[model samples]
Target: MESSSSSYLNLFVQETAFYNRIVLGTLLPDIAWNPLPHFFQTWLRNYIGGTLLYFLSASLWCLYIYQIKRSVYVPKDSIPSNKAMLTQIHFAVKGMPWYTLLPTVTEYVIENGFTKCYSTINDVGWIPYFVYSAIYLVLVEFGIYWMHRLLHDIKPLYKHLHAFHHMYNKQNTLSPFAGLAFHPVDGVLGATPHAMALFVVPMHFRTHIALFFVEAIWTTNIHDCIHGKIWPVMGAGYHSVHHTTYRHNYGHYTVWMDWMFGTLRHPIDDDESKKEF
Candidate 1:
């Protein structure tokens, strides 16, 4: 058992020094010459990259979903007001710095060899790599469901941290921008599951990073209020119900959690909900 555990531990640490050199040394060749500490440099890189990814992804999705296919997916009368969208944007912009900290700290942790992240699939073999990936996602899904539920169930936590997000509880009050328009702490807490999964699961380093960014896009998709009606998948339809009712469909990527917890509410229950903004 000790030898087996040591072998896995070595795999986690094997690429740490190499990745550290690549990230701190050559990843940002320009920053390599900068005098700021490595931590700050990593934070700065993640901040800029995250910001661009959020804006580009959100804006394009908004254009495609809210404009290009607006007629097919959204009702003219159900459009969110400019004030509502602006408010969402304002909150998102303000909270971005705090949100960036998760990735910054994650990278720092991975660089230091604290998590069960292997550098390549070959390190664990293809079969184990695939199995681990599935397990990692399941762990993340479970964590996010409970974390999100707690944000609502805990009175003090909700009143102080999550109330800001619930402000846009109506369809017309929601937009792609509202996806990340969370209180700084609320935003970080919501995504804490991804970081938590790292410590518990053996995940591919690049896959984990990609999944984190995929979440930014996923949030926007769900907030757009266009239910694709894909069963089991928690599309915007189910998310729309969550916004209006606030107690059902709290699952992140799938309905399995909500279904298992007896909190799942189908969007079809309300015909009017089909036109949610």
Candidate 2:
């Protein structure tokens, strides 16, 4: 931690860099692959470091959401049963070799002991930061929205790639494991935006790191049937519909896509939820 207080951006960057270094200097790994510089110099170092970042970041959110499930944010049984959660984790572990592509294929850099990250604010200006952030939010959501919808629209693809996740059918039966327990292809598709963004735009490395955490949390939350006033944004409630009905609400981050495509829908209710997984 910094001895002196710093801005949020500085703090996030510091935290991200610290975690990257932890994995880099240690033995943890996904696969050896690298095309960056400095601390991200070696293939093994980058593999271990990036995968470590994904695991730790995802685990932290799982812990936070676990608390919420037991407390105010949700009912005690909001997520899958402990045994079921463990099973999902096990299967997810089995798929690690494939899912490892997400981090291993992505890139990172560092300079002067600091992780190499471009901040729109530092590189350009505040206005450009706003513009880029807005653009990113729209495009990423749009991409995921179509991608999800297409998976459902295509039958063979769903059976082979997307069907496993649907097994955890209940809205409350989703945990962080459920968030990532995707078939390797599914996981890569979901993660494509991350790799694409690094080259497509000028973004702070901190923001790049933040996006992973956001994806993890949102993925878990959207599966738990937690609805909100922001109907445009696909939260827990929206995605819950997709799982149960096996149709509708195919958008990723927002209902706006669903709305625009005439797929927006209200989440299933207690009566509908009881209709068996």
Candidate 3:
């Protein structure tokens, strides 16, 4: 019989290997230390290949979301607040390490045998991958909503942990990076959902990887303040209302939770006309 310690040890090894690929592989992939001037070559190579690979994927994903928000919801003339965008970029650049450490790359390696293969993948077909993806998204929303609401509900936690994020609440004070312009603790709490799911869920690696980028783009969508006709499902418009009101609309990716809790405030009721500009 497998002992508990042995089981834990195995899990730890897999997780360690996954994280090592994320932290070390990206920072110093396939290279040894070099001396003096030649070291610049290593740095440059890592910068382009390791660093850019992570943020570039996130940036490209964000760009696609920005286009949809710009064309379908926001007016061509609308401009975001400079303070909001600059702070967002500052934090985004600072958080470049985290962008690469998402489950997508690690899971991709596991499922595709590029790194490690789990027996769970062999047990299922493609349909379960889609199902697992949907479940992961829902779990993330559920986890984030509670943590997010608690941040707003608790005075001390809000002031010290979440208030920095609320600074960008005003209209036009947002950009793609705004999604990540959060205090470190807030970032951890906000992301706890995905991390929790990655361990427990029997998800396909490809679906696991794809959802991270999708959710990253979805974060930008909420900050956009543009209420598409389908904003109830898509959630960007309602999240805008949450920023302004500061007491309602706490769902992560859907209005289901907010509506159930009576915290849901429709964008049209919040005055949709002035939100675009």
Candidate 4:
């Protein structure tokens, strides 16, 4: 009788475990809640932080640009007020979309079946969050670096599609989204490729969040023109050169690719070969 009791107890425990897995799986894929709440909290914090940083950095850059404009382009007799200059900067940056539909579409694609190879990364046991993030970052960066280089190659395409961004002929924090004002072909080719990389690479939620922040900060930094001698050390000045000349400096996140392919240059050099225009 005691032996019979032991068998029945073991069977009951196994059945309970099986039932619990079914319940949890039905509710959440990883037995975890959707992180939309957490994502919003983090996004709000970053948005606030980014706004503060952009204000200070952009102000300094605007003042620098104004000084350059006054010396080279503006009449010596008319000194623009700081308020007037700042208004221009504010309008330029604010007019562009801060949050975009491309990212939302990319996320929806990932949640659906656009690219499913990355799903296995979530199942890898013993992998830490940071490791997964690092992998995704490397993959996305590699993809973007190549795609940006490709965009600058075809002349007819570049002029018609990407000409609006070069319209600035100078750098500002507002320049990244400034491209949004471009032809629809430019928008689709320039932004969508990198946005879609997320769907191609299996990324964890943490990695996706990190990528968003990194891309935003880097994009703003590349367009800010106040880097001076400190810019090259931080990899910020090349894009400014690209703006001024309109032909070189195509890599989005890093200069290494540009350097390797003979596209990198100093901001003031008149070397037309280095210029992408």
By TM-score, who's the top model here? 1
lDDT of each: 0.82, 0.62, 0.61, 0.50
Model with the higher TM-score, candidate 2 or 3: 2
> Which candidate, 1 or 3, would have the higher TM-score against the true structure?
1
The order by descending TM-score is 1, 2, 3, 4
lDDT: the better of candidates 1 and 2: 1
Runs with alpha carbons beyond 4 Å of true place in candidate 1 = 1-33, 270-277
**Model 2 over residues 1-277: C-alpha lDDT tens digits?**
4433235345444554566556654554434322334334333443454345545655675677666445755676565677767766765666655555454445333222233345446776778776766776677777787778777779998999888878788846766567667777887787676656555555565566567556765665565555764745677777777887877888887777776777766674544423421
Q: TM-score of the candidate numbered 2?
A: 0.69
What local lDDT does model 1 show for residue 224? 88
Model 1 local distance difference test score? 0.82
After best superposition, candidate 1 residue 153: deviation in angstroms? Answer: 0.6
State each candidate's clash count.
0, 4, 1, 5
Work out how many backbone clashes candidate 3 has: 1
Ordering by lDDT = 1, 2, 3, 4
Q: For this target, which candidate reaches the highest lDDT against the unseen true structure?
A: 1
lDDT of 4 by residue, 1-277 (tens): 9776455344433432343345434544642533334333223334344455455655554455456554653343434344444544454345333443444445445434455324333455446545655666556656665666666676777676566545556433233333223454554455554566555555553346446545555655565443434432424466777766656677676555566666677665647424533
The candidate 4 region of ten consecutive residues with least summed lDDT is 171-180
State the lDDT of candidate 3 residue by residue for 16-55, as single tens digits.
3454455445666445422323223323333334344435
Q: Which residue pairs clash within candidate 3?
A: 104-209
The window of 10 residues in a row where model 3 has the poorest summed lDDT is 33-42
